[model samples]
Target: MMVDEHENHTIDTVISLLDILIIIQIEDDPIIGIVLVALLKTVTKDRLIRILLILLVITLGEVSEIKS
Candidate 1:
């Protein structure tokens, strides 16, 4: 299966838009912070990736300092 230039561009654009939406959602909703934790869990098997992560913590001041 080959993805042509137009198809690749469209896929990238959609991913970028989704990324923006996710960031907005996480910032706007307190509960949405769990989404990041869930994402971190998904990538934990890879040590290199895990070490590079900065975790978020929802607190009185809504601090976001998470660790892997």
Candidate 2:
């Protein structure tokens, strides 16, 4: 039926939008990570190296998860 076809089309459009959003997020993650690292480096001194490493690890993990 026409209504069924329209419904399917709507669903497909929504799914495509979600896919695009996910792709954008994946691409932006690294930029965000870099910015965070830069901010941390500027805001903190050598004393926070451990904190920076931990943050970097967590950010990398999130990126990997998004990729997979």
Which is the leading candidate under lDDT?
2
Q: Each candidate's lDDT (Cα)? A: 0.48, 0.55
**Each prediction's TM-score against the native?**
0.38, 0.40
Off by over 4 Å in 1: 1-3, 28-68
The number of clashing residue pairs in model 1 is: 4
User: Where is model 1 poorest over a 10-residue stretch in terms of lDDT?
Assistant: 54-63
What residue pairs clash in candidate 2, if any at all?
none
**Candidate 1, 1-51: lDDT as tens digits:** 356777767755654454344445466674564576457557666533533
Best by TM-score: 2
lDDT of 2 by residue, 1-68 (tens): 99989977875565445334333545556566456445554765543463545445566667898798
Distance from true position, residue 19, model 1, in Å? 0.1
User: Model 1 residue 64 lDDT?
Assistant: 40
| CA lDDT, candidate 1, residue 54 | 26
